[model samples]
Target chain A: MEKNRNRVIIASIVIGIVLVVNILPFLWLVLTSLKTRLDIFAIPPKFIFDPTLKNYVSAFTKRDFLPMFYNSLIIAVSSTLLSLVVGTLGAYSLARFKIFGDKHISFWILSTRMFPPIVLVIPFFIMATQMGLHDSRFLMVIVYTTFNLPFVVWIMRSFFEDLPFDLEKAAMVDGYSRWDAFWKVALPLSAPGLFTTAILCFIFSWNEFLFANVLTAANAKTVPVGIRGLVTSRAIEWGEIAAVGTLQVLPVLIFTFAAQRYIIRGLTLGAVKG
Target chain B: MARVILQNAWKKYGKVEAVKGINLEIKDGEFVSLLGPSGCGKTSTLRMIAGLEAITSGEIYFDDQLVNNLDPGERNIAMAFESYALYPPMTVYENIAFPLHAAKLPETEIKERVGRIAEILELTDVLNKYPRGLSGGHQQRISLARALVRDADVYLLDEPISHLDTKMRNRMRAELKRIHSELQKTMIYVTHDQIEALAMADRIVVMNFGVIQQIGSPQEIYFQPQNLFTADFVGEPPMNFIDCRVKIGQGTLLISFDDSVFKLQNKEKVEKVANFENHEAQDFVLGVRPFYFGISKSITDSERETNFLRGEIFAVEPLGDSKIVHVKSGKNHLLVEADSRFMGQPDETIFLIPDAGHLHLFHKKTEEALF
Candidate 1:
């Protein structure tokens, strides 16, 4: 009984420490976002500062954040959907049929994602300018797809591989053609995995600053670039930065929490045994 | 309603041959089992017949129509996979009704067929539930019901009961036999388990290393095997082998082995052996199943048993109604399954006599069956 009690006490202490570590930053983000500039620098950073919505008001209205939000949404949505269309077929083909040059091909695709994104920016800029797609949301879709397609193909391939080829064949034997079997049986069953991949792909595209800054200017500025625009030359708007940070991080947090189950499954799949 | 014929069918997975030129004829309303060990191309053969895998060469005919170029859907064959292939998103009713709906059957008829088959598979309670909500057995039966519900030309089942527990496998085996009798549909099943093949199949095609060893009814494969591999691979404990040589004495032919000689009967067989009169066989493998050997009271009870061997009991396994005794005889060991009433103590001397009818002779070099 005493041993069991000791174990419980130890567990509770560890759990308490974890909870504080995980929640402390968000609490600080909220607390600092609400404080005035004077209260923010009140000697030792006061815990009880009077809250105000001035930072949020300035962060939203004056900053042209709405258009930036729309840019991020458009690029992220289109990129995610586009990757799903092509990546799903590629993934299923790799999983089921023995395509020619499959292993080298999959490895080559994965290597592109592993390459430093900064190294590709120069060439990408040149190509985007030549095609007259520079500073356009359309080019961002292509950029997002470049990174997301590898992971998307790999993730969907694993999810499909874990599923036996028998189901699809059984469907075919039940009078469904190959394409019909994929759409009717294989694709629908892998929705949770697809949704998980979509959220991650969207998150990557939304939080991307390097490609966004290099590729966009006035019209197609994403949230991250918009947040960077808050950092002026001399007087830095720390309050606006905090508010923008909250906005940038909010959707991702909600997305992660909403589909946390699938996210964990996807992460484990990509990390191990994949 | 269907007849599946494979003409010199071969499957090559990049030089490693999976199915090597197998010719099979599965009649309408017959249950044929393709039996072998793992990686023996049994599944490859079944997939080829189902139009799932392409035949590297040769042709497959269904009811006198060439189906080599046809897709699986165009073949009109129903197949259940080893993995229970239930669409996880759909309800059990919907999964079962999928084939019927694809064939453009009426909704009412689809519901009726799905309901009846579900009841038969004991899946009626899970009709509204998705496949993920059911147990492995329930999901497997649902898959089976889906395959059986469609009135296709042929049914191809690949180790349908391999996932079930032992008791369920036996129960399902009985159910399958009953269903086959009632439905009278052409079915081809694949399994590596010898017991499953022997118990459930009307005819069996035995294969090894991508070659057809033999094709025969259960009795023909069991009692009269075509080769040494079939004799060894078919039985439960499997047939035992002993080295022997043929010698003809004055007016009698005898085979000698392990310091004992057995008089060979059948003058015609002896005459065939006499053909090798000058050219003597260095050795021959004597094949005998455990059931062919019987235990006597003692080594002294040898009466008319001329071809007798003695061994000390090593292990005694109680098989409920019978005791399988492992005895270490001279130069070799032998298994003797005795009556359950007589459980011989270990290390006791046991004399064994092979039943004349069940004894087998084989060529030592080629492993071919000899008379």
Candidate 2:
């Protein structure tokens, strides 16, 4: 009993340290976003100052951040949906059928994501320019979808593989076609995995900067690029940056917390035998 | 409702031949069991019949209609998977009702069927519960209910009760047999348990490796196995195989094991040995079930003139109804069933005489039954 208590104390301490370390920067950003310009630059960092919404007001009004937020939402959601639809079908096929060169095909799909984004950014820019699709939200969606597809396919494939093929077989024997078996039985059973994969795809497309930075500008500028624009040549608009950063992190936080239950279950889905 | 037939059906996975060319026919309303150990292609054959697996070659028919290219849905079959395979998200009721819904049945009819099956399987109380939290037996019953609730032409069950505890397994075996009789639908059951196959099936198709070893009624499979695999696989405590040489002397057939010789008194058996080629002395395997052997504590001088062979007891296991005595005669170790009250000690000399009418002779090399 005594040893277990001591072990519990040590574990709690480690967990507390990790929580503080991870949350500290985000907490500071939220605090700074609510502070006056002078309070943000205060010595020793003002932890308990009277907060103001002036930074948020300016970031939304003078900088036209709302439209950029809309653009980010559109691109992130569209790209995530597109990736999931195509990748899930591909994953189901790869999981169930004995396709020739399956191992090579899966590895090749994953290899696309291994290439550093910088390596392909220039080529993508040139292609977008040549096709007269530069700086459009459509182009940004396509780019994000291409990058996110491989991750979706790889993760969903394992989820599909973990499901007993017997479930689909049972469904088929119960008078369902192969397609119905996949859609009705396999897909519903994999809800936790789908929820987890969607959240990851959304976050990846939402927070992505390098490709969004190079591929989009002006009308299609996402929140990340819009925040980068606030770092002017003369002086860094720290208050506005912090305000937009808090706003940017808010949706992802809400999305993750809303799906937190499924995410936890999904991560540990196949750990136990049925 | 359908007579199922397999015409030289085969299944191959890449380079591995899972099911060799096999021909079988199941009459309408017949309950046939495919019995074998793991990797023996019983499950594969069931899947092929269900149309869940495409045959690598040859054909399958349902009621004389070719179903080789049909999807499982089109084949109009229902199957309970060995893995249970209950949909995790659905309640037991929905899982059972899923096939009916797929068939586009009326809501009232679907509810009626699901409720009936759930009640029959003793799952009514858990019908609202999801499959994930249920006991294994409950989940298994739900899988069975799902298959039986459907109005398919044939019902296939793959090791449905194999995972249940012994008591539940026995109960479910009787329950399944009762259901088969009530519904009178053609049922194909796959299992590795010989007891289940023997108790439940009208006909048992015993398989080994990827080929059919024998297909016969339980009595036939137990008493008159056509080959070594069937004989060895079917019986509990198994048949004891004694290596013996059949020597024809005068008008009698002398079956000798080591230095001990037993006279074959049955004229029909003597004729079988005589007709099994014209060799003077031929090696044959003598198979005797443990129950068929009569053991005596002391052999009379007159009994030695009969077919009694002598052996020393290796061990004795006293079951309630009978005692299994392990006897060592020279190099052979044989089990003989004796009366439970008969107290026999290890290393005690005993005389065992097999029933002459129940003897099985198999050719040594070919392993085929001689009678």
Candidate 3:
């Protein structure tokens, strides 16, 4: 009985430590966002400081706030939708069919995500300039797609992997063409998986900094770029930064929470077929 | 409605041949099961017929028309998946109605078709429910209904009812057989379970290592097994094999194992085993069914020269319909099924006689049948 009690206490302590480790950073972010300037920079750190919405107001007003929000929204939603459509199809083929250049194709796709974004940004900047597509939301959408497409294919391929090919065949025999079968039978069945990948792609596009800063000038600067440009010599505008950062991170946090089940499932789908 | 014929079909995965050259004829309205163990190419053969898998070489024909390169849609073959792939987002009614809707049928006709299929599959009440809300068995029924909702030339079921519970599997097997009879369309079923294969198949195509081992009626395969594999694979408790050698005599052949010798009833049939003895003399395994063995007291001693053996009972199992008695004779274990009323005791000395007519001789080297 003593041994069992000791084990139970140890397990609870370990669990508590783990829970605190995961939640502490998020707690700090929320607290800092709510704290006033004096309390935020208090000598020993203020644990029970009075909270205010001033930082949020400062953040939104100081950054070209609505445009930044709009830019991020447009880029995230458009790129996510585009990648979902193209990536689902590409992933289906990767999971199901035999392509002529399968090795080069898959390797090329995966390599897009492996190289440092800075390396691609140079060529991307030149190409966009040459093509007369600079600071344009359209160019950003396309760039974000390139950034997210590989991940979309890689993740969604695993989702498609969990499904049986017989469903498509069954649909075909039921008087549907291959395209029809994919659209009707396979697509709807794989919605949760697609939703997960879509959310991931959207979040990645929303939070991107290097490309957003390099490519956009004024009209198309997303939230991340806008927040990073908030540095000043006289005052650093901590409250505004926090508020805008909250705006920048909230959708992703909500999306991550909303689609977490499918994300976990998508991660496991690659191994679950067996 | 159609006959599916595979003429020298092949499927090669890189250098590993999953399905070798094979010819099969699935007659219209025939439920032919491709029965084999895992990795035996049974599912590959079914997939080839369904056009889901591309044949590496040779031709597939539907009603004498070559359909080798045709897509699954063109082949018009309905199939049920083992995973029970139902659209998670769609209602059961919408799912079942999808095929008909794709055909560009009128709304009323689609509704009628969906209703009829739902009724048949007992999924009528759950028509508005999504697949996630349904039980596994109900999902299976919905999957099957979705497959059957469309009018296809052939129904290719790949382990359709394998995942159901014992009671449900048996019930679904009977239902499938009934559906085949009612529809009168070419039906090719594939399964690894011998009971399911035997229960629903008009003919069983036994495959092994990408090759067709045997193709015959269920009874033929059950009784006249082509090889030791079939004998072992087709039975409930499975056919028992005993290592024995044949000793020649004057006019009559003697099969000897340890201190026992049994006379062959059909000299001509046993003579066919002469070819195997030349090469597989030391590699011979005699196959016998459980029901073929009887106690010496049950018959006259003088007439027991056919296949009688002296052994002692090691264990007795009462299985309601029959009693399975384990015999330990000359360092070998043998299974003998006797009447449920068998008054036998463990460790009792008994003379067991195997029916010569039911005994199968096999070449252990190639695991092929000798007689």
Candidate 4:
């Protein structure tokens, strides 16, 4: 009994340290966002101070940050939804049917992301300019999809494989066409996987800045680009940058909050037999 | 109801033939079981009939209509899987109503059908529960109800009761037979258990190694097996096969084994075997079911004359209803099903009487019964 109590104390201490390590930066960001510019530059940082919404107002009114936020939302939601629809079908086919060289095909799809995204930025920029589609939300969605599709397919394929073929076969034998079987039986059972894949794809596309920075000048800038825009040659807007950082996490947080229940179930879906 | 027929149907997975050419005719409203050991292609054959698998080489017909190209849904069949395969997200009612919903039936009609089947399966109380919360037996009932709700032409059940406990399995077996008669659909069941096939099927097709060993009624398959495999496979303790030499002397056929001789009384039964071994002594095997042989503690005068086996009791296996006494004669161990009250200890000398009418002769080399 004594040993267990000691172990419990040690475990809680370790967990407390981890929680502080992770939450401290976010707490600092929130504090910085609310601080006045004069207070931000103070030699010793002030943990307790009068907070303000002035930085948020400046970010929205003076810097025109709403369009960037809107662009991130449209791009993330559109690319994630599109990737899921296409990837799920591809994944189900790869899981159930014996397509020739299918394993190699799926391997190639995942391998597309191995190279650094920097190598493709130049080519994407050149193509966008030639097509006259540069600095537009359309190009962002398309580029984001290119990176997110493979991940969606990779994640959803294992989910489909985890389901027993008997489920679909039973549906088919019960007077359902093969397509109906997939749509009704297999698809609904993969709800957890879909939510997980969608959240991951949305987060990746939401936070992406390298391609957004290189490809867009002003019109299709995302929040990450907008945050970088707070830094200028004349002066660095530290308060506005911190404010943007704080705002950038809201949509992702909402998306996750809406799907939080499925996330836990999704991770452990195949760990036990149904 | 429809009759399902497979004409030389086969299934090949790349280079391995899982099901060789199989021809079976399942009559309308008949219950036929495909019985075999695991890896013997019984499930493969059933899947082919259900259109879940494509026939590698032959054609399948449903009541005179060629159905080899029809999709499983178009074939209008219901199947109960061994894993149950109940939709986990749906409640029992919704799961049972799924097929009717897919058929675009009216909501009231779907509800009525689901309710009726659930009542029959005794699942009405738990109709709102998801599959994950139900016990194994209840989940199985829901699975069966889901398949039965639709008025399909045929029902295919693949080892549906193989996972249940013994008590539950016996109950389900009776329940299934009652349901089959009530529905009168052409049902093709698949199982690796001979007892299930014998108890439930109107006809049993025994298979082994991708080939059909025998196809017959339960009584015919039990009493008159055409080969050694069927004889050994269809019994609980299985039939006893004893090696012996056959001789015809003075117009009388006798089988000799380890200083024991049994005179063949049924001449026509042993005539073919006697004719096959003309002019020379030949090695043959005699097979008899344990139930047919009687054990005596002391050799009587009639047993000493002919058809008497003197051996020592090797082991006694007491089943609840009966006992199986293992007797060793020379190098062969024979099983004798005796009355439960017949007490005998191991290593006690005993005599086993082989009834000539129940004896079976097989050619040692070919393993084919000589009748």
Candidate 5:
């Protein structure tokens, strides 16, 4: 009993330190977002001060942050949905059928994700310019989908493989076609995995800055690009930057928390057999 | 209902032949069992019949129509998987109704069929519960209910109740037999349990090493096995095999093993042994089931003068209704099913009398039954 109590105390102390370390910066950012310009630059950082919404007001009015936010939402949502639809079908095919050279093909798909994004950015920039597709939300969506498709295929393939093959066979024997078996039985059973994959894809696309920075300009600027725009050469608008950063993190936070239950189960699903 | 026929059915999983060429005809409304040990290709044969697997090079016919190119759905079959593959997201009621819904039946009819099968399977109370949290037995019954709720040409059940407790398994066996009788649909049941095959199937197909060992009625399989594998695999306290040599002397044949000799008094058996005498191989296996052996505590002069063999008791297992006595004689060990009141001690002298009419003889080299 005594040893357990001491272990609990040590564990709680360690967890407390981890929580503070991770959350402290986000808390400070939110605080700075609500502060005056001078208060943001205050020495020692004021713990208690009257907060103002001027930074947020200027962010929406003068910075054209609303359109940028809309651009990010459109690109992220569209790209995530597109990747899921294509990746799920490919993953199920790989999981169920006897494809020739299946291991090599799957490895090739994963190898696409292994290439550093910076290496591809140059070629992508040239292609976008040559095709006159630069500075468009369509280009952004396509780029994000290409990058996220490999991850979706890899994760969803394992999820499909973990399912008992008998379910689909039973469904087919019960008057369902192969497609119907996959849609009605396999897809529904993998709901948790689908949600988990969707959230991760959405977050990856939402916070992406490098590809958006090179491929997008005035009309297609996402939240991250807009936040970078706040760092001007003459004087950095720290307050506005903090405001945009808080707003940028809000949607991802909501998405992750909403799918928190499925995320936990989906992440640890294949560790134990039912 | 349809008459299912397989003409030289074979299944090959890339170079490894899971089911060698097999031919069978299952009449409409007949309950046939494919019985074998694991990896004997019994399950693969059932899957091929269900159209969930493709035959390597053979023809399958349903009611005289070739169904080689048909899909599983097009074959109009219902199968209960060994894995109890109930949809995790659907409730028991929905799972049972899925096939009916796929058939485009009326909602009222779907509900009625699902409800009746669930009640019959004792799954009515768990109709609204998902499959993930149910017990294994409950999940298994739900799979059975789903398969039975549909109107299909054939019902393929692959070890549906193999995971249930003994009492439940017996009860399900009776229930399934009754259901087959009522529905009058061709059903192919697959199981590794010999008792299940014997108790339920009208005809049992015993398989070994991807080949059919024997196909016969339960009584024929029990009393008149055609091969050593069938005789050895079918019995509960399994048949004891004693290696013996056939010695023909003075127009009478005597079977000798170790220091014991017994007369082959049956005229037909004697003729069968005489036919094999020209092969230059005198070794044969004598098979006798436990129930066919009579145990005596002491050998009488008349008993010793006939078919009795001397042995010493190894152990005794009392099973409430009968006791199984393990006896060791020379180089052979045998089991005798004695009466419940019979008391025997280990290392005590015992004599086992073989019923001459029930003995089986198989060639030791060929493993084929001689009579």
Candidate 6:
């Protein structure tokens, strides 16, 4: 019992260290955003300074933060939804049928993710510019889909494979058509996997920087790109930057907590059965 | 209410042939069992009949109508998988009701049907519970109930109770037999268990290595097996075979095995042994069940019993109802089912009398029973 108690103490201390390491940056961001300009640059990094909402006011009023946040939301939601629809069908096909060259096709879809995003930014830039879609939110949604499709397919295919084929066969034997079996039986059982894949896809699309920076200019600039705009040549608005960073993290934090159960299941790739 | 027939049906998965040209005729309302060891194409045959698998050649007829091109739904067949493939997301009530709903039955009729089957299976209390929370036997009964809810032409059960505990399996076997009699539906059961096949089937189609070995009533398969596989596969503590040499003597044929000679008095038994003489080899195999072999404490009446084999008891297995005394004579071993009260020590000399009336003869090379 003493040994177990010591082990628990050691484990708790380790966990405390990890929690501090992860949460410290966000805490600092929040604290810095609330500091006045005089307190932000104080020599001792004032721990007991008076907090202010001046930075939030400047970020919203002077920098157009709300529009950029909206832009990020629309792109993330649209791309995640689109990828899920197309990817689920592709996954079901890969799981159920004996299509010719299916293995190669699945590998090919996954290989699209192997190339660094920076390499494709130029081609995408050229195409977007040529098509007059350079500053369009629709264009960003399309680009985000290209990145999320393979991930959704791979994850959902595993979920479908984890389901017993007999369920669908039994459904068919019980007077259902093939499509009905998929819609009613296979789809509902994969609810956990679907939620997990959707969250991951949304997170990736929400936090993406390289393409969002290169593709969007003024009208379609996402929050990540907008945060970089705060870094002007003359002077950096440290308070506003800190405020925007904290604000940018709010949705993701809320999303993680809201669907924490499914996120764990998704991260383990459905290896934890049910 | 359909008569199912398979004519020269075959299934091929790439280069591997799973079912090699099986032909069968199942009468209306008959409970036929497809019995075999694993990889014996029994499941393949059942799947083909259900239209879950495509036949590579020949035709399947349901009531004289060719159903080779039909899907499982179009063929009007219901199957209960061994895995108890209950829809995990649905309640027991919805899982059973899914088929009737798919067939677009009226709401009142669907409710009535699901309720009746659920009550019969004793799943009424847990009607709202998901299958994953149910016990294995309950899940199996729910699967059966789901299949039974529909008025399909035939019901195909693929080892539905093979995974249950021994006691539950026996109880479920009895329930299945009772259900078959009450419903009077055409059911095709696939299982590797011999006892299940013998207990429930009206007729059994025994298969091995992707071919149907024999189709016969349980009695025929038990007592009059047409082939060696059927004789060996059906019985518990299976039939013992002894190699014997044939000797033609004074208008009677004497079969000799390990210093034991038995005269074939019956004309049928004599003709079966005599027919083996047409082949060059005179060696033949004689098969006898353990129940037919008698065991005695000593050989006091040796002169009266000519069919007695001399051996020492190798081992004794005391079953609750009876005992199996294993006797070893020279190179051969025989199992004798004696009364439970009968006691014998290991290595004690025991006299075994092979009842000539129950002996079966087969050609040594062909393995085909002569009678």
Best by lDDT: 5
DockQ for all models: 0.44, 0.67, 0.40, 0.67, 0.62, 0.55
Which DockQ-derived CAPRI band holds candidate 2? medium
User: Over all chains combined, what TM-score does candidate 4 have?
Assistant: 0.97
Please give the RMSD to the true structure for each candidate, in Å.
3.4, 1.6, 4.7, 1.7, 1.5, 2.2
lDDT of 3 at A94: 91
Q: In candidate 6, which residue ranges exceed 4 Å CA deviation?
A: A266-274, B280-282, B299-305
After the best TM-score superposition of candidate 6, give how far the Cα of residue A14 lies from its true spot, in angstroms: 0.8
Model 1 regions more than 4 Å off = A1-25, A266-274, B128-136, B248-253, B271-279, B298-307, B310-315, B347-350
Best by TM-score: 5
lDDT agreement with native, every candidate: 0.85, 0.89, 0.81, 0.88, 0.90, 0.88
Candidate 3 chain B: worst-modelled 10 consecutive residues by lDDT: B273-282
What is the DockQ score of candidate 2, to 2 decimals? 0.67
lDDT of 1: 0.85
After superposition, the stretches of candidate 5 with alpha carbons farther than 4 Å from their true spots are A266-274, B277-280
lDDT of 3 by residue, B247-319 (tens): 5566465677787777774768656765444743566788889888777445565756456777888998889
Between candidates 2 and 3, which one is better according to lDDT? 2
lDDT of 6 by residue, B66-125 (tens): 999998988898899887888766888999999999999999999999998888778899
TM-scores for every predicted model: 0.90, 0.97, 0.82, 0.97, 0.98, 0.95
DockQ, structure candidate 6: 0.55
Which 10 consecutive residues of model 6 chain B have the lowest summed lDDT?
B272-281
Give one digit per residue, the lDDT tens place, for model 2 in B268-370.
7788788888545566888999989989888788777878778999999988898889999889899988898888889999889888778888888888897
Error in Å for residue B255 of model 6? 2.2
- Weakest 10 consecutive residues, lDDT, candidate 6 chain A? A265-274
Q: In candidate 3, how many clashes are counted?
A: 1
Model 1 residue B54 CA deviation (Å) reads 2.5
